[model samples]
Target: MQATKKATINIALVGNPNSGKSSLFNALTGLNQKVSNFPGVTVDKKTGAASISPTLQANIIDLPGTYSLYPKSADEFVTYDVLVNPSGDEQPDMVLIIADASNLKRNLLFCSQIMDLKIPVIIGLTMMDIARKKGVEIDEAGLERELGVPIVTINPRKNKGVSELKKMIDLVAKEKQSVAPRDFIDSAALAPEVVRDIRQYVQVKSDYAALHVAVNHGELPFLNGGQKLAITNLLQANQFNKTKVQAEEIMQRYGRIKHIMKNTVVEADPLQKQLQTEKLDNILLHRFWGYVILLSIMFVMFQSIFWLASFPMDWIEAGFGALSGWLTNILPANQLTDILVNGVIAGLGGIAVFVPQIMILFAFITVLEDTGYMARISFLTDRLMRQVGLNGKSVMPLISGVACAVPAIMATRNIENRKERLITILITPLMSCSARLPIYTVMIALVIPNKLIFGFFNLQGLVMMGLYLLGFVMALLIAALLKLFISIKEKSYFIMELPVYRAPRWANVGTTMVQKAKIFITDAGKVIMIISIILWFLASFGPKDRMEKVTAHYEQLKTAHPEQSEALDMELQSEKLSNSYAGVLGHAIEPVIRPLGYDWKIGIAVITSFAAREVFVGTMATLYSVGESPEDNDATLREKMRNATWRDGSPVYTLASGVSLMLFYAFAMQCMSTLAIVKRETKSWKLPAIQFAYMTVLAYISAFIAFELLK
Candidate 1:
């Protein structure tokens, strides 16, 4: 029997950041999506499938958003590579350029750059509702005539004109035709005889040739291999002239665009539209007031996550604990049940409990981005960012790094300066990620005394906020210092689109929150689950005689002391845990970590939790619970930890030790996912290795100093 063919059409969603590109991707792809690394780059490749028609399925790629074809950072290089390079798996059959209808000029500029590529191009005109509301009228036919690309005005949130977009794609794919040849140089500007002579001898006719002229004259860099050769040939033909051809090309295009825009584009009181957004922006983005407002908003976001989500977090933790208890009673006493409850259930549940926190963070981020407040934040913070030798664009990624360093690093694409972006990426992990939160929360609850800082604010919460601020301060200082060493001469400027103020799009926000949450729960969940099973195996079984001796010895100690037996039993169990397989492993690694004030059991938890920082709490729960098997009345993790001690009769978790541990986590390379992402982004094991080594050294030195000072 012959195999039936399945038709798959490839579509690329291209746009500038904050143009509702991601929202559209989520709408189109739904749940049928996969996130991977592009062939040789650390940039993320998001590919998803959607049914366009009964006979055709669309394989959609949400490419990294770029402002122009001139690549600046590593992320932009990846975006440029995937689109321009022919040797790729995810090349688009048709390019769907998404433009914000309200910001037609700026958006169209990017579209004009891509239109010259031979691929069939279509436009998804987003934010049409906002444009119409503002009395901005778009001549769709005029735009099509200017660019020769089909345009479909759609509100992605409302799901309007999406079918038309799909149909356009289907039709464009079937009939492969390039957009019209509108990209060209001013051959007419030259003398008639000179223009004719050059045209006949130059071996160039298209916009790509104009691009060469512009690049030679310092307009934009020559983009492709063909363009480079064409430039060389033109130079050779014209006696290797050193004129600013590239600069001339840029001015020529801009002049033409302005002319067309003036003739066709209609605005309902341009000054009024500009004023409407500016009125709100003036206060919000003021030098002093902007800082105050930004800080206040950040404070609210963090406070809401902790205070509001606490109820949900508690419910999740309690629910998981109850489920584990129920499973323990119902299942026969066996290794499998133990693994299921303590290892898989308890381990994974620890991460699940924090979903509310992650979701809240996402929700706030989405709202800020949707309402165009982020650009204002960037604009307001530019001076401060420049002082720190970084761009204002670096702010969002650094802030997002608090939630996760990996994505924050990926988010650095919008930064146009290469050196600045790299420096930002290097220091981002210094900001404590959300994965470190469980450990911080646990340790803070144990060590820090809850009292008001100035007889008003909660001391503990203030301390938490202090840690966050401290991280930001450190990042700024380090970046400033590092800038002195890395020599780069590119002029840095911040220019960003500040979209009109509008109510937050809940549909877009909700979709983003859920999609990111799902990715976190599933992708991180897999690594954690496997580690749980392995940890179970190591903790459960050991050498037969050693295990038997451990049990007999603990039982005998319990039998000897009647009143004090309970306490003695706990001590005996802790001792036996040091001799068990998992315990032995911790002991072997304990010497190396002893200077850092960590014991064998602590070492084991740290090592196991290297897979993910959040897993520290889960690792501690399983390691301590499995070894001690605390009685039903003393089931709380905090209570169990309170009773833990060293052989020298000192408490295991002291204020000094807790603070030291927190500092260690603050600077440590604990997240495996982060390492993987670093490798992807840098395209070399060398960078990841360097990152791991330096971070580890920093963690150790910081922890050592902290412990010694407190000791």
Candidate 2:
């Protein structure tokens, strides 16, 4: 007989924030996962594949973490929509509730509510070790009988109990995704009229699901215009108090969960001594010490990025220079060869050279997050943030801005206050995103000496840290200023659940490092290469008459000094580039940027890098390579920039000019991607317009002041 075809099952992993949902998903899916957005929203949807048994294959969707079915943020809304009204395509056949065994009550409250929805659910209890350390224990079978669903204790990090969980999932799916035998709490008893009315008109799976639709029918995407109108009229006729009904439902669910916990769980006395988490919190959360430690950690992170990445960076830089030289020799001398060697290769090499530094930075970030110290960072910075009209919640997004502002701005969706969210979005771009890493690295190397501070700290690393701090400090100041102008009185509170710190997952850290480096290379690489080619075209050719004159002058000079052929050739190429279209465009903006100590070449870079900040380095590489002297053919980008001079033969990049340029990039709203995200989040171009204007103005002023003072 032929083997049977595998049955496909879709499982939705749901839980409150920090309840081990992601850990379980990672364990189940391993490398068989992909990330995307939920339909019509920016909230991330993580879906993966897993094999449950010989004949069972599963599609696992890791839903956004949320507290309850009642939705507040877009993240919660997506999860709620998926669970209550799963369409044909999104067949969440079984909902796996990832409940923290230690925090059973709260997790159970959320679980029970989902159970009441009459969907198939299996509880994957996690953090058992922590719960045991805290002297908390539960009778698994008893709890399972009480909730009318299978329960499996797991520690996904160790690959424990995952097979059992899969077996349970397969059993549930085989039973036709059996709904709970009884509701966790009767929905009709709380609001008989509303629930009955909804059930009569709305086609739903159960009374509880009908209640959910009735309460939030207006927001449900599946409801048609006629259905919504009908439900709205029924709600009005019944005078259904939505908030009142929701509160009652929550109260009843919790009351039953409390009883179930009392029957099945055993806990040590409250006075038995504080848990380990509490013990650590006392030190890590200390007011003065906490700030000191936070800064120290940040200092170490920045310093390590430089210390660890320097060797690899040097190797990459040397390799690219050698490759460019080799390709130039092998390829025929033509526009195509010139473009390939001097334009595309140079641009790619510029960005690729920084991958080591990028990976190092992301690795550090990933460790902080994996170990749960990232949450404490918010707690430590909350007071300081609130002084600028933000709270601990805003701190996450701003700090996240260090990685990239696009997701950081998207992160502001959790900030409840309108004014605070707007301020966060407006200032997030100033947080010195990793895209600015290339610019900062090159500028600091050019201007700041490579030395050690106090024989312990790297001076270059200290300056990089200072640049980040400068961006953060400026964000706070700007936020405070905006707070004064945009007056809307709204109360905001920061409620964060700081999970117990655990050892860093090295595998996850490595995965994050690789992923971040890949995104940087792929996303930023395409832009840099295109701009480089265009720039090469602009810098390679000029108006017919102007180009002929430059070539003629150079040829005459070469003829006069036959022995200085190579030197004259270099000078000729430089002269031709100055007369090229790119040079003309740069000169147009030269006067405006002159006060900031920038010349036409630097002006061109600043203009092009507005598409993406990392492109600044790529632009430099292409420009300098195209204008290279025959004698300086193998010289690196830094050497080329160091040798650059003005018409008067004075060096172009001095302390004043390099610092000015750095400051300009540091403050500028130079990323179109960030602006687009701001518009999407704010739902208006007006705010993005204002954001662009203010940041550009700030960049100019800061650059101007630094140049004059340093000069």
Candidate 3:
């Protein structure tokens, strides 16, 4: 007889937050995953391929962690929809339920829920070491018998028992998975009439799945208008109370889980390891010392961004400079050559030069998260956050804004209250993101002196830290002001689980840094290059008559004095750029920005940088490169900006103007990506429109004040 066919199947990793689910996923599908948003949602979906055996393979889906089937946030909505009614690529054929053995009781609640969906499931036990340290012993075979599913203990961090888990996965996949085991809790008992009615009204997989349909049929992506209406009618006719049903469901599941644990697990006095976790928390969570340590840590992180990265940043800048010079000397001189050397390469240089700093920043953030310190930050600031109409949950998104606003805004899904979430999304962009790092560093280098203070602290680093603090401070103030308006009010709570402190996973930190670097160099680089090319066209050519007139005027001078050919040619290029199409556009806004200590060239950069904040650097590079000769290719962007002058030949980028530019970016809604995510998250154009207007006003007023006072 022919062997049965072994087709690739889907295996979703599902669990509660901090359950080590993602860690196991990383181990199983190392360097094989890609991230994309789930269909019709902004939430990220991480999928990877895993080989279960020589002839068997499965696609792995890492779902967002949730406590239970009933969801309260947008993130949870994605998890629920996928587990209950997956669509397209998200369909789950078999599931690996990642459960924390150390917190097995709480973990079983989610595991039981996923099983009731009638899908095949295997419980991959994690944190067994931590469980043993707590003097808790569990019979895996006994628990497996009681749960009626295969159980495998795994430590993805140390690569323990992973092969056994994969063997179980292969065994499960080879079997026909059409029939599921008995329900952990008889779902018919929850609301028999309503469940039956919905089950009849719509063909669902199980009774519990029908109950979810009754509870949230309207929001489920798969249900159509007719089906949703029918379910709604059934729910109303039965007078179903969603809150009561949800609460009762949790109580019944826990009761069963407690019984299962008591029969199969034994406990004694916890070892000193558990005690150490508590001891560390005492110091890290101490009110006074916690705040001080947090500030000190932040100060060092920001300082290291500049200090540790300076060497690599300079090397990258110099490499680009040398490449541009070599290309200019060898490549044919024409419009294409000009675009290649100036537009593409210069834009690329602007993006690459700051990657070291971006990597350092992401590395610091990732370490904080992996060490479990990030959660404590939220706890420590919960009260202060409450004063501004936010809670601890809002702090994560705000802090994440330091890396990028798009994901930070998406992070607001954790904020349960509508008003607080919206407020958090609106102010998140005010926190300096990595995209702003280039602008800040360039401006800071030009204006702030690089000197050490008190023999240890760096002056430039202090200014950098101050700028970050300013972003956080301004975000809180804006949240306070926004709270006074917007009448949607609701009760808010900050319920968080502080995980046990462990040393950071350096591998994870390194992976994050590499991913962020690739994203900046590729995704951000593409946008900057495109904009630079467009800007180059406008800056290099002009109204035919004016361009020709300038060329003719410079030609006559060069002829009159052949010995001054090089100098005259330089003047000629500058004159032509001043009369070009870009010059006209910049001049159009020059009047409005003049009082803020900006020239026409600065005006052009400001207008074009609305595409993204980092585009400011490329814009400056392209703008400055237009008037420079091939012999001047070695000059760095900072050097070019330093040499910039107004029409009167007076320096344009003085102390007042450089600070004014930095402050403008610190407050401006210059990233269309951030604004777009805000609209998507809020599902409203009005909020983003309002956000743009208010931020523009704030930027102008703040920059005007800075320039006026400093001047």
Candidate 4:
């Protein structure tokens, strides 16, 4: 027998930036959340299922943060579209508007706008503690009575008042409550004739909806061509001033907000004290000290990523190696055994070892974001970004690119200007991401000496920082150059609200770190595992005659000189690899990469890594037969790579080769995932093609120059 089913309720979480909306979402959804794109847009749609009661399940949609209904960026547009379009998938049964109690006047403006949309609204008032600390007190019942909406004071970070908020949402949704009786503005007065004319053709939800149609009918996707033309004709005929009307509407709403605050909120005394945020900003945002602190923070982040992750990485490597060895001993030796140990185990280990670094990096990023310094970074870098044909908003995506380009590129949706957004998307992948870190660490360990400079600085860490800086420099240079060619005349502005600095939310930070690391391992592990098996096959077998000849030659050598069996066995393996299909393909590209100080094996890695940058390590481990011994597997791979040589008996991974490889990866568009995302973002293959072509050329030239100079 089927169990009784519960009706699902959709609740939309809407708020302004830094309104504690995200914290509330995390608190409600916990670990049941999933992130995906909205139906036709790149804006992230975070949805999760939460149980409001034993028999009631709620599907929560956390919309992008927007200050007002008037959309500016892509994310805001997503929020606006979902709210206004009743037939859409994310059309919420109830709306929860998260507002900062400390900033009631400004928060109320948005709350007023949402109420005018005529949806079932519940105000989730957050940051009440901060308000109390500032000596600002709010009368929640008085405010609710005046607005005609339910108001719940919540501290989502501490799970306070969350149960009450859920109950209110359930009541509102089940009761099918009508829109609040209060109106924020006289929308009919703003554009009387235009609103009247538009409502005749379309089913308008409220007077404000009609006003929005009059102003933005041309851009609204739901409107038919005929309806849009009708609206356009009406606006033209009425000579409706959209700008003047919007300005008047905002002024009227703010006037009402001031009145509401006067009735329900008691403000802190002016002479009480400076805010904690203001006090912190005085030193943190100081012209000289801000830059110094920001730089120091970055330096420490990179250093810690390397230093703190070393022990965990070593442990993971050793554990994996021992497991592989144990498996090899227990299982009978065959092609299947070889594939299992050398291909799957080696591939998994290569990527798993980097989990520590990934976690550390994401943890640092999360802490920075939670503490509110991330916004300050954008504020500080805005002036410099504008000089490079970009705006301050571009800095976040660029900084985020250091983690991964896919999400960083997705982050560009917030950039309003098309040219600025395009340029930001194009150049973002140049920032050295964590995928490149595996390559950097492996190569640096091979070539760069691990030494302390000035007794306090890590020489390896400094080099890592230099590589990161190089990526940023190249990104800026490329943006400036692209700006010269792609000319679009549009005004750009950077208006950001800097939230007060708070102590890092350790739980949120830990969640972010674990989630990001899990994503990296699962995503990269899939690609690496598949490619490693294919590579193992191609490196293990060759043409029947050639395989036999190579085997016979080694057998003869071992028979003649029994004491040199180990050396002969190594020769046979090398010969078999050389004649295998993978070896043949590598040889085909070897000549092309020879001048860049790469051997045939590196050529293969370069080709396979088109799937993902991290696959290079797995490919190398498979080709080198790193699974032969289970113990000390991490060092085994490195030792094998160190001993690799050209036909001329010269070491392959010299300073020249290692540096060249790093430069190549730094500039190359080697990630197919990145290219696919670029295509999705631009909605054209032409841009990704251009991106791939230019990045390939840049990588080759940079690699060549680096190799030639060092060699």
| Poorest lDDT segment (10 consecutive residues) of candidate 2 | 627-636
lDDT of each: 0.74, 0.88, 0.89, 0.88
- Could you tell me the lDDT of residue 35 within candidate 1? 93
Worst 10 residues of 4 by lDDT: 626-635
Error of 4 at 29 (Å): 2.0
For model 1, residues 1-711, the per-residue Cα lDDT tens digits are: 975565888888899877888878878888898998877555688989988866678899888887776666666666665565444676677788899887777777677767655567888999877777778888888877777778888777677888898887777767765555554334334223333443443343343533334333232222356655654566566554334543554566677667667766787885564546778988898878888998888777766766777788878777876777778778887777778877788667767877887788789988987788877877787788899889888988888888789889888866778678877877888888878877877777677875665675565566666667777887888789868976877787887667677789898789878987897688668877887777777776767788888788778767876778877776665666667789879888989888877888789879877888877877776776666552331254555566777887888888888888988888888988888876766567876787688778978898899888887
Query: What are the runs in model 3 whose C-alpha is more than 4 Å off?
Result: 1-5, 86-91, 176-181, 221-239, 270-274, 330-337, 555-567
lDDT of 3 at 670: 95
Point to the candidate with the largest TM-score: 2
lDDT of 3 by residue, 97-169 (tens): 8999988888899999988888889989999988887888999999988888888999988899899999888
Please write out the lDDT profile of model 2 over residues 1-711, one tens digit for every residue: 999999887888999899999888989998999988787787778999999999999999998888888987777888899888845357587899999998999898889888887778888999999998888989999998898888899999899999988888888888855567888888988778878877777667778888898889989988889989998888898888988999998888888988998999998888888877788888888999888888898899889878898999899989888888887788777889889988998899889988999999999899989988899999988999988888998989998999999999998888878889889999999999999999998888888899998888899999999999999999999999999998888999888889998999898899899999999999999999899999999999989999999899888888898999988887888888888999889889899988988889898999899999999999999888887753355668888888889889988888999888888888999999999999888889999999999999999999999999998
Candidate 3 clashing pairs, residues 3+ apart or interchain: none
lDDT of 4 by residue, 8-74 (tens): 8888999999999988998899889999889977778999989887667889999999889999989
Model 2 ranges with Cα > 4 A deviation:
1-3, 86-91, 330-332, 487-489
lDDT of 4: 0.88
Error of 4 at 296 (Å): 1.2
- Per-candidate clashes come to 10, 0, 0, 1
**Measured by TM-score, how close is model 4 to the native structure?**
0.96
The total number of steric clashes, by the backbone 3 Å criterion, in model 2 comes to 0
